[model samples]
Target: MDPLFEFLLRQGDNTLVLGHRISEWCGKAPVLEEDIALANTALDLIGQTQMWLGYAAEVEGAGRTADDLAFLRDAWDFRNLLLLERPNGDFGHTMMRQFLFDAYQIQNLKALEASSDPRIAEIAVKSGKEATYHLDRSRDTVIALGDGTSESNARMQSALDALWPYAGEMFLADEIDQAMAADHIAPLPLEYRAPWEAAVLPALAAAALKVPQDDFAHQGGKTGRRHSEHLGHMLATMQVLQRSYPGATW
Candidate 1:
């Protein structure tokens, strides 16, 4: 696979999988405000996914549209971070996941604002606006919940502990990353580590959330070699409509 295409898939898959997960909370969030907010967040992520995957298709020149790539690909082909695929157990858990991913994304999109590829830079610019809002919203929620009460704080802490290890995957680089970096298309994922930590750690400290002591990073989500069971189940529901009715347009 072309490194650029793989890089695009990683970008799109992260949003697509996580977007579907957030959308699962529609009508199920604790309050009306939260319900609407979750839906809108999902929409933002999905919209970003369209741009990333759309560009990936053009780069491939393989006659696949964004929808085809999104709806037709199997789980093993996905290259999202494993953290996003983890279950959103409670409201606090959801926010922790969002904050972690958004911390990485905020700096990432900012970095991409200087990408050598003009298209990637433009997409990053547009997506960065939404990502800023996402980080702000999610970070506020994390702090509020983590400092709220015994129960809420406990849940937030638990979520942070469980998800922190997965956070390391964002920084571990491979050939695809090297290629992107070498071409000045994008920086190596490793380049974001300091900023991601700078962005994530303080928010977590403010939340009274304890960062997990164990830092065993689960690898292979981006490389698509070791995705968790969660992604397969997600794809089933997300792609079911298109899978069931191939070329069935409304």
Candidate 2:
């Protein structure tokens, strides 16, 4: 597989999966304002996915559109991070996951703004704007909830402990990362990890959430070798419309 296509899949799939997960909160959010915000964020992520996956399709030259790549592929074909695929256990858990991913994206997208590939740079720039808002919203929510009453604090802490292991995979530099870095198309995991940690650690501390000590990370999402059962379930719902309709449109 072309490294660029693979790289685009990682970017697109992350947003696609995470966007779908976030969308689960659309009508179900705790507050009306929050429901709107969550829906808007989901739209932002799916918009980003369109850009990334559309580029990927062009690169692959396989006559597949972005919608096809997104809705038609099975679980094994996705290359998103494992953390994003985890079920939205609760409001706290969802916010914690969003905060973690937003922090990671903010750092990397800023770096990607300088990518040698103009297409990548353009996508990064546009996505970076939305990402900035996402980080702010998720970070504030994490801090507020984590530092809130006993129940909220405990839930946030639990979410952190559960999701921390998955965070490590975002910084695991594989051969594809190395290749992108070598060509100046993208930075290696290490290149952005420092800033990601810098952004994340202080937030965790402020939230009174204890950062887990474990460095172990579950992998395979980015490689699509294996994904948690949650992803297949998500795809079943997200793809059902397109799959059943077979390119049906207005």
Candidate 3:
């Protein structure tokens, strides 16, 4: 496989898996308005995933479609950071997860827009606009939850604690990422983190949310070494139809 193709699949799979997880909140959000908002964001993410994955499939020249790359893949095949697959515990938990991730994604996509690879750059350019909105919406929710009722505040804090470890993986560059950077296919992960943190901290402060004190950041999922427990059930639900009826499609 071409290295760029592998890079594209990694990006697509990350969004697809996370989008699928977030879509679970469509009907279950604590508030009706929030439910709609989350659903819309999930749709945006899935749409972006489809475009990237479709391009990735073409690059691979393997005759696999976007659906094949998404639903047909097993847990081990997914390369999303663990933070995304962490179970959506509560409204606050969901918001916290979204807050951290959306911030990173906005910066990441903006950087990718300038990628030397035209296809990658084009996808990033288009996706960055949607990602900007996602970050803003998620940021507002984080602020609201953090500054809301006592229970909401505590729940948001707990969510941050539980989800923060997984965030370390987002900025840890590996051989694949380095290759992409060297080839001007993507930006260095560290370049995006500072700006992401700058945007996140003020929001956290306004929400009265404290950053997790834990210095130890978890890593290694990119190599498929470790994953969240929720991934199994998620995979079962997502892959059931594909597994049951291989190549079945509408």
Candidate 4:
């Protein structure tokens, strides 16, 4: 229950889950160019996961490696925000989901790059650059789709409405976050929320997307207490190769 362990795990879990979701589009994207783009973004996320989870393994001082932590954990043990685990409903939904997460993650990483913990800070710097690219891609897609044809606009708006509630979970401050902030290991989740809003709201407005007024945020992933059923299904697929051929590597 170390604060750093939990903090690092949560960071890894978010990228891992979302990356897997994005990877689902490898061959299914709307166009050939988009397919390649989505795949590349997924790779970026998976790479980020390795850095974060690899560090978490070291911090835990346990025998578990990053692969063990990622491929062996049960559903309830994951600490990702719920937004990342939701099924990708459509192209619009996928972009909206990425936009929401990228907003918070980019800000979080920027602050993390200055961490009192040098290891975390180094990882943050590397990952933060990747996040900046992700934000640009997602933001551009959100704006273009939201301001496009009536049908595209409607779909983008719907995606925003469905995904907005989950966004609040990214900013929820629990003891682990408070402790990390107190030690200068990381910023409090709330620290990024306002800037996240500032970046997102203007994008949403430009896209003609309305921000949902609902305050209900589905949480509990950080404490490893709750997860959508989708995560279990994702784990089943993601861990299969590792589980079937334990320790097999190139």
Candidate 5:
């Protein structure tokens, strides 16, 4: 497989899996408004994933469809960073996860907009707008929950603490990333980290949430070295229908 295609699939697969997880919240959010908002966000993410994965398939000259890439692949083949696959424990936890991931995503898409590959750049350009909105809403929710009632504050704080370590994995580059950087198809991972932190810290402070001070940063989850226990359950829910009725689709 071409390195570019591999890179795109990794990106697309991450978004597809995470979007599937978030979509599970569609009718389950605590409030009607939140339910609609999450559903819309999920749709946007899945749409972006489709475009990227489709392009990736073309780039690879593979006969596989985006559905095949998304649903047929086993867990070990997935390359999503650990932060996204964690269970959504509570509304606070979900919003914190969104805030963290969306912050990094916005930075990434903005950089990808200038990619050497025009297809990748175009996808990034289109998705960046949706990502911007996601980041805004998530940031607002983080602020609200972080500064809300004592219970809300405590829960949001705990969410951040639990998720902080996984944040580091977003910036860990491997061979594919090195190829992308060398080809100017993407920016260096480290280049995004400082800006990502700068963008996130003020929001955390505004939320009255203390960023965790843990020195241990989580890594190696991209290659599936560390698996989230929640992932198997998530995959079962996501793939059960396809698994049960092969080639069945509406």
Candidate 6:
């Protein structure tokens, strides 16, 4: 596969899946303010996905558009990390999941902002700003819930443990990452590990939450080799209108 096209799908697919998961909370957030906030956050991710995937279509030159790449892809074709496809459990689980992904995203985007490719650089700069806000929001929620009460803390702790196993995959580099790094397209994923840990650990500390010491890192989605069953269910719902109507638009 074209490395740049594969890389773009990696970025866009993760954002698309996570954004759709978060959007599930639009009308069900614990409070109206948070409902509005989650909706806005989801919008940011969806917008970024569009830009990245739209660029991917251009690079492929196969007559596919962003909508095609998103709604038309099968579960096995999505290149999103496994963490993003996990079912959103409680609010605590959702926020912790968001925090971990956003932390990596902020660092990833910062590195990409220096890309030799002008298009990638521009998208990185635009997306990084939104990612920063997402990190802040998710971090705050983690701290609040982690320190709130026995029940809240237990739930938060459980979330951390469940999500920790998937954290390592973000830094797992393969041929796609190596090619991008060598071409000045983006930095190696492993290079962002230190900073991602720096951002994530302290927040966990402040929240009195402990990181699980799991060495088993579940991976494979980067190459579209594996995905959680949740993603299949999600895509079924997400692509419903598009699939049924076949390009119906407002």
Model 4 alpha-carbon drift over 4 Å, by segment: none
Per-residue alpha-carbon lDDT of model 1 for 136-230, expressed as tens digits?
A: 99999999999899999999988888888889998889999999999998898888888888888888889988888887999989999999998
Best by lDDT: 2
- What's model 3's lDDT at 77? 71
Candidate 2, superposed: residue stretches over 4 Å from native: none
Q: Which segments of model 6 are wrong by more than 4 Å?
A: none
TM-score: the better of candidates 2 and 5: 2
Worst 10 residues of 5 by lDDT: 219-228
lDDT of candidate 1 vs native? Answer: 0.92
Q: Write the per-residue lDDT of candidate 3 for residues 172-229, one digit (tens) a residue.
A: 8877888998998897788888998899889999999889777677764565667767
What ranges in model 5 sit over 4 Å off?
none
Estimate, for each residue in 190-233, the C-alpha lDDT of model 6 and write its tens digit: 99899999999999999989888777899987778878788899
User: How far out, in Å, is residue 205 in model 4?
Assistant: 0.5
In order, the Cα lDDT scores of the candidates are 0.92, 0.94, 0.84, 0.92, 0.88, 0.93
Taking all chains together, each candidate's TM-score versus the true structure is 0.98, 0.98, 0.96, 0.97, 0.97, 0.98
Clash pairs, model 1 backbone = none
Candidate 2 lDDT for residue 145 = 99
The window of 10 residues in a row where model 2 has the poorest summed lDDT is 187-196
Best-to-worst lDDT order: 2, 6, 4, 1, 5, 3
Q: Flag regions of model 3 displaced more than 4 Å.
A: none
- Candidate 2 lDDT: 0.94
Instruction: Pick out the ten consecutive residues of candidate 4 with the lowest summed lDDT.
Output: 219-228
Which prediction has more favorable lDDT, 2 or 5? 2
